[model samples]
Target: MNLSIFFEPLNEDVFANLEKPRTLGSYISYFVSKFPDWRAADIAILGVDETRGRSNEEQAEDASTAETPARLVRRKLYSLNKGAGRCQIVDLGNLRPGISLDDTYLRLKEIVEVLISHNTIPVIIGGSHDLEYGQYMGYEHLERVVNMVTVDSSVDMTEDPSVPPNKRQLRQILMHEPNYLFSLGQIGYQSYLTEPEVMATLEKMHFEAYRVGEVHRSIQEMEPVIRVADLLTFDISAIRHQDAPASEPANPFGLTGEEACQLCWYAGLNDNLTSLGIYEYNPELDDRELTAMMIATMIWYFIEGFYHRKNETNFTSRHFTKYAIAFTEDNPDRMTFYKSKNSEKWWLEVEPLSAEKGTRIVPCSYEDYLQATKGEVPHRWIMTQARLG
Candidate 1:
């Protein structure tokens, strides 16, 4: 696919003042005078300037005049020093917004699907959170069940006609036909902001939702949740307003800047994660570009984590420690677990309900193994079993 046709070449004036030595901009293949050769790139940076998803007309009008949120983020990202990894990155430039919001979604979906099919991970920046629905659609033709994780303050499941697409995109994903979504895990949702019925609906679907306080208490626990995902969508609103004030509905209480980056790091290390979208940033509301800088740092951390991936999925290898626990007394049902010697990550094997289904190796934490050793079945195990059935 000729991706350049769908994109607008980045305005050089936006980044012209940047000093290139040792900075990320020096190492990146970007669209300036001509489109970069993205075919060989390992990571493609995509910018989306669409914001019509916002219900507030005033906010949308302001976005039209202000510098695009994506450009602001790119400026900050380019100024950071390059990481340890040899960068095979390409900045595809901002996608041209279509005449209608749904048109924009289809364009994004097509671009993301093509990028993933070529084994290039797309690091999407800007746009409203509803754009994630397009990101989710990218996986439709991949011929596998998808696991998704979203970091947001409120569940975007509103049924009200007055609500904009950004506020109800999750419902669209859930009801999307040909249902390839196997599991969805939400992180950093504030209880007060979420509706009780939405929580109940997610529970009924056998999905996972972690409260903001729960995530903040032990951010490390989120590693397993992120590791199992095939895609991750982060809403800037999930970060505290003080840290990321540019969001549509910036919350007073949410993940700290540090915690948000930590989650991105975990997402980067996951071998299964193919695409990432960070959304809902409005440059008009930013305080001296602090929110833009924060988003840039989060992207930097994700790239650092990507370079540090251990690729330790082989359980039978000598680099892993295996444990067999008998969780039942009468039938003595056995469970197998593996811990990576290199990265110290954990995984457990769950037996499928039928022969055709086979066994599943699920990402887990050391704490889960401790629970199993005490003659208890871990909740994660039970959840996986239910989903498999």
Candidate 2:
């Protein structure tokens, strides 16, 4: 696929002030005269300009127009120093929005599917949060179930079909068929901004939901949650307005800048995760481009984690220590867990009732291990079993 046909070339000035040596810009292959060679690249950057998914009312009410999110992100990224590995990254430039929102989604889906098949990670920036619909659709042709992890303030479901895309996109993905989504994990949700029923729906589906408070209490626990994802998206609105004022429908409470970066780092380390989208950034609302800088730092951390991937998920590998626990004969609940000797990260193993397959292992916290030792089952283990069923 010739990507140049669907993308607008980067403006000369977009790279004008960038430094030459050791900066991210020096490491990036930008689509200036032509599209970058994605086959040789490990990661690809794409920008989307469509915003029709945003509520028309909010678009009309905001006096200040939104700035091009991808441009702002590029400016910030180019100023940063490159991480320690041979990172072959290509910037695909901004995608040309289709005549209709659905058309744009289709274009994005096609582009993403091609990239994934080529083994290049797509680092998507900009467009409305609903643009993730295209991101989600990218997995349709893979023929395998995908686990998606999202960082947002709400589940984004609505009873009314006519609601804006941002409010109903999650519902759309959940109901999408021939269903390829194996499970979903939502992080950074605030109770005030979310409906109780939405959370209930996730629980009923045996999916994971973590509130803002739970994340704030111990953000590292989210590392395992993110590790399970094949696809992930972050809504800028999930960051507190003080740290990221660029979010539309801005909120005062959410993840801090540092916390957001940490989450990105965890995502970067996940070998299974292939695509990441950071959306809902309204640069028109930014203060001194602080949010843009914060986002750039998050990307930086993610790249750092990517280079430092340990590849220690294999329990049988010598890099990990295995442990097993058995409950009383009456209880009948037995569990196996693994801990990485290097990173100290933990994983719990579950066996399905059927003997057709081996035990399924999932990323878990140390607390889950402690619970298993005490003859109790962690909710995460139970949820994984339900998902298998």
Candidate 3:
């Protein structure tokens, strides 16, 4: 599969202008007509130039006009220092927009499918949030259930067929055929912006949607939630308008620039996450590259966390300590938990079914342990059980 045909190389002038001494540009492989030898790389970066999803919105002009978003991001990215741990990363440059918007999605889906099949993570710089639909579609041939976590200011649950996907992408993903989605989680949603009915629907479906205030209260709690996702997308508009003013849906209050980086770090640490997209950055509305720098820093943190990953998935290993807690004195059923001696991260073990060969380990916080100990089940545990059933 010659992926180069689907992508164009980053402009040589862009790289030539970057100060190469101790910068990220010196380390990463960027595509030319010849693709980088990406088989050994841990991650690949791709940029999309399609923004038809913004056409239906009132502020379509704020979306990226073809290559501007990627170009600005690349400039900022080249200036950052590579992380402490070694990581093989390849930048695939931009995917040229197709004849139609659907054509563009098809192209992205095929490219992403190839990357994931090769076990290389794709860090996407998107033209609009709806491009993530293609990212999700890439998993169709993988023959496994996928969980998606999205960082957005609002859940796009509108059922209006006339609306562009940026307004209702989540609804489309949820109803897509083959039903490969096992769960969906949303972080950094603003209560005021999201419709009450949409929130109620999320609860009814038992999917997790965290408010911005909840994340501010305990950012650590977000790590486990992010760890459960196989794919994640960060909507740039989720950051406060002051920090990330370039997004069309930008709001007065939301996650801080620092908090956005922290969430990305958590996503990178997850053993299950194989794909990530940072979407909706509009350079036209940015203030002197401030938003671009913030986004670049988020990417750097994600790569840092990726390199620092500890392979703690093996429960039987000496690296883990097990605890068995009974919910009630007379109850036969008990919850099993594992704590990593290295990272001190917690995981709850779910009961295996008849056809299952091993127990299912779900990411959890210490609070989940406390809840189970008090004869109460964590919502995560209950949701996992229902999904498995």
Q: Rate the local accuracy (lDDT) of all candidates.
A: 0.89, 0.87, 0.86
Query: Residues 232-315, candidate 2, lDDT per residue (tens digit)?
Result: 999999999999998878799999998999999999999889899998888788889998898888888887888888887578
- As a whole number from 0 to 100, the lDDT of residue 115 in candidate 1 is 93
Clash list (residue pairs), candidate 2: none
Mark the regions of model 1 whose C-alpha exceeds 4 Å error after superposition: 56-65, 328-330
Task: By TM-score, rank the candidates, best first.
Answer: 1, 2, 3
TM-scores of the candidates are 0.96, 0.95, 0.94
Local error of candidate 3 at 266, Å? 0.7
> What's the residue-level lDDT of 259 in candidate 2?
94
Task: Give me the candidate number with maximum TM-score.
Answer: 1
C-alpha lDDT (0 to 100) for residue 80 of candidate 3: 83
Best by lDDT: 1
What C-alpha RMSD separates each model from the true structure?
1.8, 2.6, 2.5
Stretches of model 3 off by over 4 angstroms after superposition: 56-67, 352-359
lDDT of 1 by residue, 123-172 (tens): 99968899999999999998889999999999998878688889999999
- Clash total of candidate 2: 0
- The positional error of residue 55 in candidate 3, measured at the CA in angstroms, is 1.3
Provide backbone clash counts, one per model.
0, 0, 0
